[model samples]
Target: MAIANESRQEEQNMREEHHGAGRYWLIWVLLLVLTAVTVVTGRIHIPTWGLVLALVVATTKGTLVLLYFMHLIDHRGANRLVFAVSILFVVLMLAIPLVDLGTRYRGATPPGSTVSDMQAIDIGADAMEGRFGGGLRKEGKTGEQSGSPRQ
Candidate 1:
């Protein structure tokens, strides 16, 4: 019984050592502060200032997610480099909207024009039925059947 208890305690100690508590407390506090900032930014419609503040909050969250959750903070050299490259790719992804926005004066479709044709049909179920051609039995009626014991 004593040996079993000692083994259980050792296992618990090992688990604590392996996982640790991390820096989740600080992370959580930062997350909460950022959340508050974001919410406040939305409330005050200063337009110009609000946009900047929102971007700052968003960047903070991105950094936290990348460093903490994604484990990039623990790694050095190549891993960090890749993480940076991935972040750059994300920035490039975000820049696509700005690219389109910059060209907005060139007769681009305005915002909220998601569906160009509102009158588009919704024959989704019909599409499925037509796809199968009423299953294999329909083909049997179409004069094409496999070898049938030719007497």
Candidate 2:
């Protein structure tokens, strides 16, 4: 009888732990919408503010996942503080590298390239040539397909 009572208590605890399928479905939809917004912003390329917008969207999504999917919303205060600190560490790690990269001089060779025999090249031109379907390389700055007359 004691064993049966313990099993019943375990089942009751599990039932109380669940917030319900409705809440989960709602969160799922919100996450999807945020993902779509991120995709759109990435493609549009708003220049200076683009990276900031993307980071904001990513942080929001991460917070939602942590609070809901990870069950951190109802977790103990100590656990929440630990998670927050870990997130702060991660942000610091990423921010330091970004800051260093942004402040670096143009055309300066990156570290580890010195070990290689290869020399530096025009990164911007190469990237633009690839992205514009070879139009920039084949048709100058017009970006039109070669052998086709512009209307």
Show model 1 residue runs off by greater than 4 Å. Answer: 1-22, 49-52, 106-151
lDDT of 1 by residue, 1-151 (tens): 8657765766576556554455877787889989998887798777445655787689889899788766556555566788789878877887788577556652355434442323445556555435544322222454654333223
TM-score of each candidate?
0.48, 0.54
- Expressed as tens digits, the lDDT of each residue in 92-146 for candidate 2 is 9879987876766645546445323355555676655666455343475778775
Error of 2 at 116 (Å): 24
Instruction: Pick the TM-score winner.
Output: 2
Error of 2 at 54 (Å): 2.1
